[model samples]
Target: MKRIKNYFTIIAALIFFSGLADAQRSPQRAPQSKAIASSEDQCLFNGTYRIDVTESDRLYSVVEDARSSVPVRDQQQFFRDLSTRLTPPDMLAIECQGTRVTVGSSRAGKITYLADGINRRERLPDGSFVSSKITLGVDSLTFVSSGKAEDNVNVAFESLEDGRRLRVTRRIDAQQLPEPIVIQTLYDKISAAAEWNIYDGDRVAGKMGSAQPGAPPESNRAADALRSEFAIWIEATNRRDIAQQMRFYMDELQAFYLTRNTPKRAVRLEKERIFGSARSVDIRAGEPEIVFQNGGRTAI
Candidate 1:
């Protein structure tokens, strides 16, 4: 009877300790998750980005408005600004594993989420913030009052079919990264001396106009073909092959080269052949003419 009582007592103590340990661990896990997850207020980034509609092209304007608020003059500038957004500082999220944020059609308009990071913010009619940036794992994808925090709020979908429109909100604080470890390891390759491993060879290969053999250059195959053709053209020109040169140039360029008049040469006189005063030689632009003292005394 005493043994049974002792066993029950022991089991109760184990349960009590496990519960206490769980309570201690739960708080730690919450902060770690919160660190990656931003609040609605924290995620709320608001600023006026300009978009230029030159000739009121709906297709172009729609595409421009769907991606970003940054002002763009033409399609070229549009690509440039979008490239910037895809990079650092301006972007809200990096590659979040198991966390995806997308803008597309759904039953309740377009919805964006942090998936499992931070609670999202509510969007107002004027695109004002109702709360903080959505934390990850907060599966709240509703715009009930236009007052609660939302991930995708005030977003104007350019077209439901193409989804080309752009609406850039404030960039999230992804710039805040944890301190890098100084210790050398296989995983910390980019931060350590390993960055130089491929970079040094790449630099050399670029200067020499070839790849390092082990790794292919990032440029397309078309560029390599063009470079090879240029080399062959240079070689043919150095050899002075009329047939090869004719093959290298097009019809108009070949005619232009052949018809251009060659300049005539002047009389040759040695430095010692002339005597008396020196005279300046005036020559026109694009003409090659040399003048120097012919005699030991001076050339006239």
Candidate 2:
């Protein structure tokens, strides 16, 4: 009887110790796994989304209805010209992640948007990280955006994603509206996206370096035009004057760039910026690498 009691006592002690060990290890193990999961799970919005052409609509009828108030020209040629320009976007690519949003063609250069109040990490050569927060502002009313944006532009960001909203926004006056008009674009995701954040920095010219290698001579000419334009733009940016930047870009690009860097106040260059100059980023650009198409108007 005494031996049996001792044996039972030893068994109980072994089980208790085993339970305690598991309790301690479980807490440690769960959180490390959770951390890894969270990092991998990420935000669903963090990827490159091209317009699902079959599922996307540009809403040209909204424009036509608003413009219907304009006296319809009876001339057939005028009507034909008007019809040509109103076609829906055949292809649109949008990349959404953290704060950066890119809108344009995959082959062509894209307009980059840095959202309002999101942090981006810059890793130094020494393997230290510093954070810079970016804010995106949009001014839909302006036909011109020289780095600075003004007047009644609608700007807001809602991050809750169930896969039915757009991160970028804009507004304008239309004849059909009693008030200003607003448009929200929606995006869809792709399966493989190891390179979504390609436009991480350098909003002035986005990812032009990716396809510049082995570029033909004619493409070099196109790239030169882009470089010369950027030279003026860089000077304007250095001057801390939005108006100065406008001189280099086309009217469409100026508005798009300014709109993307929204809330106007956040994107300004300080008069006492510490950097004296920026290093020239080497680009091996070719014309085919960047394709821009808007109503049959094409450019590199």
Candidate 3:
């Protein structure tokens, strides 16, 4: 009887210890992930969004009705430009990641909204990483109205991933009606602003006789013409038009050196002269900057 009782006691002790051990070895509960939600997430930087501009049927009709108010040439450009900018069916999904906004139409894989913004990092399927930073601000706004015309109106943004800070502004006419009506008006205003920004930048860079920073001390006409020709030549090459490529240099040589030499010779000589005077020529997205190769190349 004593031995049986002792055996029972030993079994109970072992079972209790085993239960405690199992409890201790169990996995712990993970912390819940947090999400930042806001009423204004539609315009958040890097926030994915779907906007339906076509939902406002009345507004669309109104714009169409007033199309005749604009001049014939202006109307042609306006409709063409607007058609290119806005997606069909009035629905557009945009991912505001970094300085870029990847816009999609009704379905997926139709990315079109590429604007000036900070660079982003993309991970490849093979595990490699690529980073592209947008130089200009992605969330810039310029407002104009009958009474008010302010340039910068920065707004605050909080990063959901890393808690980084971002700023933007809603540039629109202050006297505009309520949100429903103003959304349409604001969309037009903002689109114009973006287009104008790009146009102005390109125009300034493309204008003949425009001075580059740190270029050789040549006359404005010579340097500007050379740059303008170079731009055309590069564009022609990119298009892969052999005739255009030939004509670019031919025209340049005739205009600058007063020579009707072969394309190869003209190109070689032009390159030599340009490089001889250039310490360093920086070809970038913005304005081209040059440094003298020989002496100090002051910007002309």
- Per-residue CA lDDT of candidate 3, range 106-219, in tens? 222333222332233444234543332222132331111111111111112222223122222221211111111111311111120112122122223223122234333354
lDDT of each: 0.25, 0.34, 0.31
* Count of clashing pairs, candidate 1: 36
RMSD of 3: 28.9
Global fold similarity of model 2 (TM-score): 0.30
Error of 3 at 66 (Å): 2.1
The C-alpha TM-scores of every prediction are 0.18, 0.30, 0.20
Local accuracy of candidate 2 as per-residue lDDT tens digits, 95-174:
44433444443333455544333334444334443333323222111111111111122333333345333343334332
Candidate order by decreasing lDDT: 2, 3, 1
| Candidate 1 C-alpha lDDT tens digits along 1-300 | 332233223222221111112112211223345333244322211111112222123332322234332234343443333333222111111112233333211011122333342333433345554332223322222111122221212211111112112232222111111221011001100111111122122222232222123333433243345456656655554554335534544333212211222221110121112211234322222111111112212211
- Sort all candidates by TM-score, best to worst: 2, 3, 1
Assess candidate 1 and give its TM-score to the true structure: 0.18
Candidate 3 off by > 4 Å: 1-60, 67-90, 112-300
